[model samples]
Target: MHIVYPAVVSALLFSIGVYGVLARRNTILVLMSVELMLNAVNLNLVAFDVWLRDRLHAGQVLTLFVIVIAAAEVGLGLAIILALYRNRRTVDLDRLRLLAETPAPTGSTSVPGAVSPPSSGPGEGP
Candidate 1:
């Protein structure tokens, strides 16, 4: 009974996580959803370990590893999102796409045929 209950709960959690990841555009929300999925897997692992009479605590050990990796992933992902936001001044996915549409900033001595020259200028020879 306990095994079945935990398994079902874990599956539900996993499904919810998937939905959140796919439906949400915010990077932070996606990250939180990922964490939720990881936690669901951890719950399943621990539940199975408890149900089975294992010689070694393999499931628990694996759960620990999952938790550690999840923490690292969130840290790295947040850092990347922060950097992107700082560069673009917005976190929305739609707005971020503007970055791709726009060309790189122009400067003196641009590569030939790479970028167009300034429309009008007095001392603009590049």
Candidate 2:
């Protein structure tokens, strides 16, 4: 029943979640870590609610809100991960770095010695 018990456990869970989020290369694992962190928060909210003995039970109410949000986050996160996997064929975060890089092409857009037409200024009427 001591507040310290839940506080310490929540801290440990939160720490592990942080490590998972930071050190894991797989996107799915990262999402799980985020869920872990959210659970830690929920635990702390319930612990403090019980400890305070408030009539309104605001802490517990907020914990319920957090749980709802966490559920929505998981749903959205999985959808995004699935989409990325389909497009890239892998969910490895490192491999996703290339998503930002534009590969040099042999097409006419940037071919050697090709002159680009000048842009029309705002003052010039086409």
RMSD of each: 7.9, 9.5
Where model 2 places Cα greater than 4 Å from the true spot, the runs are 99-103, 108-126
lDDT of 2 at 116: 26
lDDT of each: 0.76, 0.79
The sequence of per-residue lDDT tens digits that candidate 1 reaches over residues 25-115 is 8878888999999999999999998888667999999999999999899899998887665444456654444323345377544322323
Give the Cα error of residue 11 in candidate 2, in Å: 0.2
TM-score of each: 0.74, 0.79
Q: Model 2: per-residue lDDT, tens digit, 1-126?
A: 889999999999999999999999999899999999999999999999999988999999999999999999999999888756544557888766542324457543321212222343221135
Model 1 clashing residue pairs (backbone):
none
Q: Could you tell me the C-alpha RMSD of candidate 1 in Å?
A: 7.9
Q: Which candidate achieves the best lDDT against the true structure?
A: 2
lDDT of 1 at 63: 96
Off by over 4 Å in 1: 98-126
